[model samples]
Target: MTAQTGSDGPAAPEVSDRIGGRLLAMSLVLVLGTFMASLDSTIVNVGLPVLSVEFGASVTEVQWASTAYLLAVVAAAPTSGWLAERFGARRVWLAAVAVFLVGSLACALAWSTASLAAFRVLQGLGGGLLPPTGQALLARVAGKSRTGRIMSIVGVVPMLAPVLGPLAGGTLLEVADWPWLFLVNLPVGLVAMLLAAWLVPHVPAADRASRFDLRGAMLLSPGLAAVLFGLTDIGSAGRNTPIAVTALVAGAALLAAFLAHALRADRVPLVDPRLFRTPPLGAAVLALFVAAASVFGTMFLLPMYLQSGRGLSAWDAGLMLAPQGAGAVLGSLLVVKPLIDRVAPRTIVVTGFALIIAATVPLTQLAALSDGWLVAALLVRGLGTSMIASPVMTIVYTGVDPEWLPRASSVLSLVNYVGGAIGTAGLAVLLELRLTATGDVAASFSEAFWCVLGLCVLALAGALRLPKTAPSR
Candidate 1:
């Protein structure tokens, strides 16, 4: 966390309107990595059905492709901040990209779902570190004052994820084999890597001897996995079995122990608990926690709904999600870019969630809604999603010191994964239970929509604590 941003790294640079061409190039280059990582999170999901058939496995088994990647991403969190600072952001980022490329090639070559999951874990480790490290590097150059606007541009990746990911996955599958899904990242990634080697500036390590927090990493990673495993146990078993209870308890205890270690540490621990002391960062972090769930859980849910509820093909469902992606892109351009730098984050976030809540109202009636109605509702939700995410991320860099930016990104990214897992897993559990108990598919999904609504309300509560206005230049 004490890592230097530059020679005058600690001095806050003024936000210049005329952001130079060099900076913009750097930003775009960094965004390439962000796009790959973010896109991977959803694109592979569209291919799960294909994987199921190819491997002669159940959907439940094939799902580990996505889950294993997510879990690996979570596993990579604690180490990402350290990696960024230890080896320098450039080397670490390139290394991550290389690893991700390797994982992608391996996944393309995988023979079974089990092999794919294993390789994905390797890929997830790299994918997990890229966004946080990339953001930290960009923030180092962009300065806190410019974070809101620049971050808004970066928001395009996530905002467009709902659009490009599924659509691209669906479209690709139409013309090629499933292996192409993983292979596609190769060219794009190589271009990013080569450009990064040439264009991205290097920030050297501040402390070579900054001992890696092996203890903290151990506690945090396993702890998160255990909790997720417990949640999954409940989802699959349909009851709170002894294994679920034990896992839940053990995971809680480990997390508590890690928190105690972080709070009382003399040297900055991995994910220092004290980082929250920075104004509004805590609130922003909390908001992102639930926001991940609300956004991603819905992303997870809607595709399934279309495929299962409407009996559409995976590619069709992916195309059907285009409206939401379109709405998000428009919102980012029209709403977020202008307002994010001027308006209060609290207001923007609240408004975003409001749109989400409104959109979700239609989703609750998925049983009978036409594609037109569903698309319209999703479009609204997409707008809300951009409003919530970009503003909160804006607060992340602006609200904290440059030295803490990497760790801040790490913590925020970590929570986003955990929160998304909780939401997605919970929805899966509920959908499974309701489908079994009621034997009414639409009704079960309709009931799950209520949970998404609840997550939105919960996130809004945190957003209320965000700074009333954008951080001044």
Candidate 2:
């Protein structure tokens, strides 16, 4: 990739052909890092039931295995850019890998649910850094023009994780024990650490003489944690308790405070509020938030439909979900970048959202009987998701100045997690309410699917606001 200076400063030296091997090695390391981080999100889900039985814990208690990890990821995400800028991306990335490996080991060795939850939090701390760092590295390596293709390849992991997590987890659970789920990360993370240490070029730290914004970090991290925690608590709290209401209210207030603090800070803030002034960047952020809501919301509901509505076993549900990942990979490989080059990104995003709407419309019509139509719907939805994912990110990254890359990328990552939490919580509450009112699980899931379908339509509307062409930097 060719390197050109952005308005901020001179660009880092491009990786030359002499270092092609090194570039390939670093890319592999990044992909591995991304896979390790994303795999944990879904892998633990399939093991939740086994964990409940093994620990003699209630279903609600065991669910924390997933919830705690997600909350930890949210808490740690804001620090990634600051940490990378202060310490250097290579150092922060290696530290993150080490933390992940250690946390995975602790999780494997844990004897109780509480201990496992704590360890998962450590793992989240490590995992959260991978995405932003990976994106930054790719941005540097691929340069300005090829950012879409490079990011598209990296983007496959998030889509694949839902499918691979359960497949890997189910196979491991059948063959061995639950701890192996955590144990699996050790080898992959170690390899990534080694490769990153060797192949990633060292960029000089950002003018670190500039003081870190500790106050902003404090507010953003806990505020995000509280918000996600409150949302996850809704299912257990029945959404009516004073405690739940208070947690949600406090979390929202803190987040609002964090926003105000970020906006007014004289020094560089943890998140750069000025990026939002750019029209494309602002719209891209909103589109990412809504896209995440549409995608993960369906993921949260689909497996439940397969299990409770279709009466498939956990393993079978996982097997059924595999096609979605396959379709996503296929779509990415075939259409994502080429289509973006030929058409406006806004057009691609709008088309993607429309496809999601098309695919999801069929789910509302699902019956007690299993058939090809359900599988077809999932495949099409995966295609729609893949179609939008990479292009949306490319728009976000390419829209801003290079200095703001980290901040913009971090914001997008943060929105994704928050959107996912909201989506999962909102759909779960809707499904639960419907199930309570009507005895049929299928009917409830069908109602939830339609809600998701509506969200996709909303995302399409937001996509319309995206620039018809890539903006000049």
Candidate 3:
């Protein structure tokens, strides 16, 4: 096969030609890095109470360990595209893994709450680069044609993180100290780095002479950080109080200014806002926002309902949620991928959202703690989520210029993170508001499920407008 430049730029003929050999190996290497990075994002939560007791800190004070990491991740995402362009994805990825490993070690060694929180910030900086860079690399290699199956593989681990994190954390705490939580990343990181170095190709970097969008970056990065921080506070506090409101408003205003700057700028900005003008890309982004809300929202709500409402243990709650991961993985491989290569993304996405709504509505009517009905609902929820996420994400890269993949990847990553935060916070607030008035666990959970169902409906509406087919390269 000959290399051909599309509306984007040079296609990855070299990598595409070797799809059965080195390309598969490199994909696995990148997937490994992404899985670890994504896992760390949620794995510390079950250990939070443990850390609180160990450090003699309160719940609110201890949360900053996770919050600081999230803020750092939001701040770091907008920079990943530029870093990949200037330095090449392979080099930047290797460095990211190394930095993550170092940060993990430092976190394990942290003696106090403040120290662990600070080290988490360090970890976040490295972790933030992994997702976007990995996506961009895979996008460049797979091009538009194969993004469906490839992203399915890359996304599977992250999708499983929420389901697996509490289980992993609880197990670790059961057997060892809190330090082991961070230390667990050590062997994984090392293996990923070695595999990446050995199997990944030296894809050439973009021209380094483009004036970096320093001013836009200044606005965008911190704006995202603020918005995410505000939302996180809302989720934790279970309210949209003064602090959350102020931060959200301020962050929204700054982001608006950045949007104006990016649209009007003569030079390329950090993320090319014009990409959103494309119909398919725009629709895909909207679907992504909704998809993220449903995924994170349900994950947040289900566990609370199981453990706090139904009085199950953390470990048991995690086990009950395990079927969601199984259904999601099965759907992605057996259903989403095949449909993507054959059917319209619009059909797949709309059907997926419909399934999500159908599955979630049953949560409102759930009566018993140990009913097999809950498991059945979760499995359908998983299938629906995989159907929506995998297809929408694959179509996102279709028709884009290859040179723009890095920035596009960054934009998607930022949106997913932000959307998940919003869903989590919004649902938590909803549940809290219901409980305050009613004090009924089942009623409050039902109210939250209604909110989730509404979000899924919005997603379905957006999916209706998606391109009828994947954009031709």
Candidate 4:
């Protein structure tokens, strides 16, 4: 099932066609953590206004609930690989689930907006750790042969979370209270933690991890957080404020330093700079980043467009977005994995971006589109997204040695997180400027779609650089 970049075909026998047995059981357990973490990222936005009124705070002040969690998630992501290597992926994942559970309950019991936001930080740390660590564990279990199918299982969670979050939040609010948003995580988290403890096997801690790239950590960690904070500031504060500018500059400098140090470091750095030069890995990282921006940025822009251009209620807009979830499911079931074993991942990724580009072109004519047309475009885009995420991620996991998978997952996850933030923030800023200049909402969205389309096109370029076939381990 291993495909060598140097070979004309796979170096091993065909991979299994489906997930089953204990691997399936363990995958479902990991999915619980992934679902909760990804779900909370979007779901809480639905409760922001309710929280503002409950605490008698300004909407902007209550907005910290989401912002704090986001920054916490970004900040905590870099530490996950280190933790997994030190304590084992299964242990780190279990600890993350427990921490997330406790944080969720604390969030439910929060007495003020400040408390809620603070509790969300604790929650976000766990949320940040869960996905990558769990992915490492599962990828180790599935190995090169079954990596694509594993991705189809796990990658689908985040895709569906955005579509489902608002609905879940709205339903809980209608039937219960704002606390239910956080409370919903309790049962799921508990079940996941317990099941994983009983069923998931431990990955041994690395002896090389003893070196612990303290220098790289110092530089890259804050560098990443600062960049994301700056981007978030621009989105929330609107335009390039002094804080955003300062953070961006400082973050860039720190990141540059980290890369410099990593390249020359005596020991294995936190993330090996060489990974970027490694085939399939570097290309996979770029592809995921662009895909994240296009998918998540559009996720941000569409809600506003739907509310303004189509004059749909938030609830209605959420429903319109539901097509993405359906398309994701359809693509996974009918297309992505089926061809993955039979076709080169390079072909899947290229075709995925092509679909994404074609899907995005419709949005450029925002003013002229009808509800049905928009839905179809989003559905196709979701399918394209599925096509990209599974193959691209599988390429990363399967191509690398299992010993290196933790850091690769960490690097790719960090890139994806920052890319999503950039997309959301960049679009927000561009849309604002466009609206101010044109005074036409439709025209502003059209301009923004052009940007999304441009990013997708750039991603496609990177996709083409990926090995025309998967490489052997």
Which segments of model 3 are wrong by more than 4 Å?
1-21, 238-240, 368-370, 470-473
The segments of candidate 4 whose C-alpha lies over 4 angstroms from its true place after superposition are 1-18, 237-240, 470-473
Instruction: Give the per-residue lDDT of model 1 (tens digit) for 1-473.
Output: 24334441242233465567777787888989988987897788778879999999987788779778877887787778888777777788889999999999999999998899999999999999998889888887687666777787786575466467888998988999999989999999999998877677667665543677777888888887778767666655335578878988998998999899888766668888777777787788777778778777788788878888789987788878888888887888789988887888889988998898899988889878998998899889888888877788888777677666788788877877778778877898888889889988789999999999988888777778888865553
Error of 3 at 232 (Å): 1.3
For each candidate, the alpha-carbon lDDT, in order, equals 0.81, 0.78, 0.81, 0.83
Q: What TM-score would you give candidate 1 relative to the actual structure?
A: 0.91
Worst lDDT run of 10 residues, candidate 2, spans: 3-12
Clashes of each: 0, 0, 2, 3
Residue-by-residue lDDT tens digits, candidate 3, 237-261: 6344799889999999889999999
Superposed by TM-score, candidate 3 places the C-alpha of residue 440 at a distance from the truth, in angstroms, of 0.4
Ranking by lDDT: 4, 3, 1, 2
Better of 1 and 2 by TM-score: 2
Candidate 1 lDDT: 0.81
Best by TM-score: 3
lDDT score for residue 338 of model 4 = 71
Name the top lDDT candidate. 4
RMSD, every candidate, angstroms: 3.6, 3.6, 3.3, 5.4
Ordered from best to worst TM-score, the candidate numbers read: 3, 4, 2, 1
